[model samples]
Target: MDGKTILPRSEVPEEFTWNLSDIFASDDKWNEELEALKAYPERMAAYAGKLGESAKTLLDWFTLSDEITVRVSKFVQYASCRSDQDVGNSFYQGMRSKAFSTAVALNSAGSFEASEIMAIPDETLARFYAEEPKLETYRRSIDKLRRRKAHILSPECEKILAAAGEISESPDRTFSMFHNADMRYPDVTDAKGEVHTLTDGTFVPMLMSADRTLRENAFKAYYKRAGEFRNTYASTLDAQFKQLKFFADARHYNSTLEASLDVTEVPVEVYTNLIDAVHGNLGKMYRYVELRKKILGVDELHMYDVYTPIVADADVEISFEEAKKTALEALAVLGKDYTDVLEEAFSNRWLDVYENTGKRGGAYCTGNGWPHPYVLLNHKDNLDSMFTLVHEMGHAMHTWHSCKYQPVNTAEYVIFVAEVASTCNEILLMRHLLGKTDDRKQRAYLINHFLDQFKGTLYRQTMFAEFELQMGKMAESGEALTADALSAKYLALNKLYFGDTMISDDEIALEWTRIPHFYYNYYVFQYATSFSAAVAIANRILREGESAVKDYKKFLSGGCSKEPVELLRDMGVDMRTPAPVNDALSLFGELIDELSALLG
Candidate 1:
């Protein structure tokens, strides 16, 4: 459905809408909290330079910081959720802007807290905790701050960096505006000779169409516009990489990759190992592509042919209610407590379901400790949307479990393990569905869907991850990142990954310009790693049952209390090794074999 044809927010059923009032009953209350948060910086200022005074003083600073953090979380969460509910809403846009400003001010005001704590000798900090038992509550947080001692600069320099934070984000902000609001794509005609406006939302679905003409037209037309604005995209991306390099250099890191991975203490080898493993398994992907060409009966499989399903009538239309039931049933393996949260999410209006005008195109789970996590989904009644519901609910349940178990300071999980929970849910759901069905076509469709996930999340994201690493290196080496250079690099990688089975069109080269994730520094690789980890965990749960579920639940509850690698290690998936990636690729190959037999 087109955005213009979508229902207005008010017209959406109340049952389908998220309960934003749970955060604040009215705008008046939200504004009241906003005004109250504006005074937090002054309150935080009073204890800034006095952190070394005594144990009680330090405890008081932490106490005030926690209070302000809770309030800040609520404000930002509410504003963002409200704004995202309808992006065109001016009032919520202003509110989101003000909340961001308050957050920056709060950060600037509290910038000295870290440096001051670092200045306190370790022996002194130990003595303070000994003297005041209450200080023990923040030991983990303090330890985290102390770990960054080497990177912490002088208070003045830190303040400058804090002040420049908003300015540094201008490129990404401009790209967001350009991609979401400003940039326009041309309309393309489908096989039926019906014209549809090609959008980022509709682009993939068009590619998934069985009609080669529709897929080719959509592919060409979308990139034709992207090709026109290549220079503009390249300029914005160049500025973003330059910003990444500036921070890496300022922090004395060897590269942007190091700087990004160090934040979560992930080793550089984890990233490199993923690329290496994928490279080692390139034959499997090439074979899969060759299988697609053979099954689709295409003489020459182009890039557009990659997404179309090989199984006929595989795009099953599943209603939202059916999706909810299937998600609940599929996740019951996680045990009753986990399924209870999913039930609450459905009955208590935790989701803003369905596509509506101005609603965000994709799906995500968001909220704060103050309220239950809220989910936004542009749900279509299809198998893809069913998996999306399960995927997002996995995130919501993770947030629910973490907030319920962990302290507010450590409630939020890092992005490294964020996809683990969601992808695990997807894997388990796929398995459950596959187990229950013996229908040949149904099995083929389900297996095909699973294969697509591996292809998209594991291989495709790793390709993007490699591209991101290369771009960083190029920018650091003082090479100009022009449109032609970026496209050529991207096209080459596409050739390497897709192999000779498919024709790598020039239009596919413009794929880099349209990917929003490249703007995210070294972020796409985790999707690949997390999918691998999830596969291992899902396999364990299927094999070992309750014991595996117990371990997985503990991992979810731990949140940021431990580093991501250590957490995954505790869950029995060692990302540092190539085992998980190779196992996932092996499973991909097995699925292809199953589909091949079924198709025959």
Candidate 2:
């Protein structure tokens, strides 16, 4: 297909794919930058022993690293997005594969450098900081460095870890490449008797269709196709688990989850406690599902009806341009700095919004620890897509701020805290919309939106967390994670969460086959934690004002300046306590009541 054949952001031609020119102005410029980036890692050999020298040496190195990080990050964003646009685009794919090597080399150097910094005598570091006033700004980053220093393996061991690095990530990368290449869906017939080809782009729209028949056919089409590759998915996922086990053993951690959290200093209990809290409130979720069944008036609610539109003829159709405006308005509370970046994102085209042949499904904002975060969305002009855009931009903004304000070593925050900024954007959008809308249907739509947040982030994610934890435990206890065992666990959890309201059949049982998070090694729980914290943060910002915004920006800019959980606590939301989780669940119940009232 010609590049011009790409789908527009909407039915209109006035829309365009995201603008990357804002970052580099042209591909020629990016090539020049890529060349320069590949050269910087080798330069690190000169700084071998210099990291522990003095505050001035460290500070100078940090500045140098930041500059290099920004440039390399830009190269990465450009290449990755291009590859995503067309997984078959060999030019960009080859370039990205090469870039991956550069990244691995750079990461090796980084791990080595940070490990070396940890070896410095405490007295020497203190003396250097005292002598260099500018270094005082980095107190938190330095403190975190000190904490991680204890976990720092010997330099030789660290080199071994780095050398075998990319192999550990092969499972994920291979799955992504294969799924993009081979995953296919059957054509779905809509209520009007028109047929639409079921690609990832059309799947969600079908699910959200007001026509139950369309949703049912769409779900059947999806799983029937996905089911063909079950054995392959299972094998790839198993390899991913083995990789996790390898790293956990290599790092001297008890398990993959513990090893992963050790990167951000989050306790494993944070995950366990989240699932437990959500489990305690599973009744609320079941009731929500029950309400869905009643509202849809389906005698037997199927998983296909899960995302079916409740309000017949609901008018939640938001255009891309309007969605951009809504995002700007919804995030208006983040102060001038936030709005400024957001404005730049929209106007300057920091996103590629159009879906083309081979374009990856889903949305995310990713940047190396430096440069502005680049976002990719398989653009669909709908309210949910609007939320998706703003949600990702939140991550981009947080990444931009963290990299700008923190040193190279601490610029990357833990994924645990990473979700706070994104989900806060989501909660903010909901609050903004709910405040402005009074129409019962719109309010109901907004209420549905909030409910889905709990469904996806709180309830659904907790279920995923359960699967993750059980698998990890099973992996620890010498149980094999075969396809049947995994599917049984997933289906049973579905039964638990859905209760008597909906059917939990074998088709939905294989739903685990499609989830990429299983490869993530205990990463799903953050969605719940982040939602809890976001509820607290978003509430404070709406109830308070500039104070909350100021606090949030501090949290964003702090990055890995300290332990992420501690930074969130300093900024007002405490993940360690269950208060936020309880508060969030209470809010979910309130939505359930509102929707119940409207439908009744």
Candidate 3:
């Protein structure tokens, strides 16, 4: 480990950690709940063949199912969050596995529900709804199931699939273990001969270093280490896609993408449309890449150079306290209700701040099931980390709003719109920073930051989206996803997205091995789409003031109560059209112009 010491979980200050006691008072309490939950799956088995018996029977099943869901969710969340806090801890990992097994058993027990519901005639369901007043609460869920009647397999088949759930998670689990727990990155050395610990948490920060040697060395070492295990990574990725294709084909979906999108009610066109929009605007990305090379005073811009600040003087450290204060100030436009919850997040131990030994890399916000929205950050004192603080707080707030407004069944928002609130917060933060600074250098720095967001969130994620699409199709066509094949496709994408200015270093091709998102099953595309939607919404909030803020919050609170596209449409950005993506890229083009002028 370099000069920095990542504290053990036990040594981390109590104030800096999230309070898991909010979910369960202690490990004993969690175990007690686990034992109690084990009996309920058998109870669910009692309702297996009885869903279509009558209105009361169906209503009773829904009540029982929702209760189990909430409890099991809390059970799984606690164990998984604990495990995430320290991936090296076997006790928590065992607990998490048990939780998953319990969930799988419960799923198997309830596997008959969907098919039975689908089997009900339209007229019978309507009659049941009329008979049971409370059944109206699940009308949307019921209707959605009915719509997918074609996809719902026989009850016996569903039971088999349900049983396979835990086993099917093998690829993701394997990769997670490899990336977080098993893989070891070599220590990188700076020009001064000082060594730095290179880890998942430290890799990006090293790339952001002002020292060119350190950046290049860290970049080479990190990817080179990953490249060594390329075949193993490729096998896991192959299994992931194959599993997706298995379920897709089993469910009678024409393609894996179709199956994935169907769950969210998103049209396939939305996915293709995003790529089409980004492809149309490649020139903007190319121009930005060219400008980066010019500003960095480098003849060749390597992959390692991409993250270092083009406006070097503006790169500065931002303490955690400063991050929280600036986040509150920047997000004040979101009104009192949002800020109130945000304030609680800062003070109430809702965040597990700072990196620790064996802690998971990156940042995320989870509710650990309702009433407690938690954020995990490998927090560094820098502008990027400040933006990360606000970004995750956005997710925490969205979880807070959705849970407060929507019922349990519909509270969790789909992946499609999940990134909107987070990215919108980022855009707002950038604008806030830009507006407060009169100094040309500061403004250029902020603009560069915004441009980088466009590059990373918009351009880079779309490239990832493209790679995913190609891989999925290749899998469907029976093409093998070997390490060399994956790396070639990934490198080509890097070249295309970064334009001819980028070196497309061979080390970067191994990047697919490191991405946790590929296992997410077509999840990265939404980052680009969400960034587009956020650009539009952030601009509206800034322009229209209270009315826009009101609508934006409404969208956050809406959850899955309405279709995601409809919810966004209600807020004025329509994902059904290409306008949002085009508008976002237009802003990217304008920002490049703005940054160029400022630099001049």
Candidate 3 whole-model C-alpha lDDT, 0 to 1: 0.90
Top candidate (TM-score)? 3
Instruction: Give candidate 2 regions above 4 Å deviation.
Output: 1-15, 25-29, 49-63, 131-139, 368-370
Q: What are the per-model numbers of colliding residue pairs?
A: 0, 3, 0
Per-residue accuracy of model 2 over 76-137 as CA lDDT, tens digit each = 77778767877766787887777677777787876667677788888898898888887776
- Cα miss at 151, model 3 (Å)? 0.5
- State the lDDT of candidate 3 residue by residue for 1-600, as single tens digits: 111458988988888789888889999999999889989877888888889889999999988988987898888889888999999899998998998999999999899999999988888888998888999888888888888989999999999999988988889988888899899999999989899999999999999888999999999999889888999999999999999999999999999999999999999999999999999999999999999999999989999999989988778778788889999999999998789888887887888898898998899998543656788998888899999989898888888898888778788888899999999999999999988989999899889988999999999999999999999999999999999999999999999888898899999899899889999889999999999999999999999999999999899898788888998999898999999999989999999999999998
What are the Cα lDDT values of the candidates?
0.86, 0.78, 0.90
lDDT, residue 280, candidate 2: 88
Collision pairs in model 2: 18-351, 18-352, 19-349
lDDT of 3 at 242: 95
Mark the regions of model 3 whose C-alpha exceeds 4 Å error after superposition.
Answer: 1-5, 367-369
Say which prediction, candidate 1 or candidate 2, comes out ahead on lDDT.
Answer: 1
- Candidate 2 — what's its lDDT? 0.78
- Cα deviation of 281, candidate 1, in Å: 0.7
> Number of clashes in model 3?
0
TM-scores, all candidates, are 0.96, 0.92, 0.98
Off by over 4 Å in 1: 1-5, 8-10
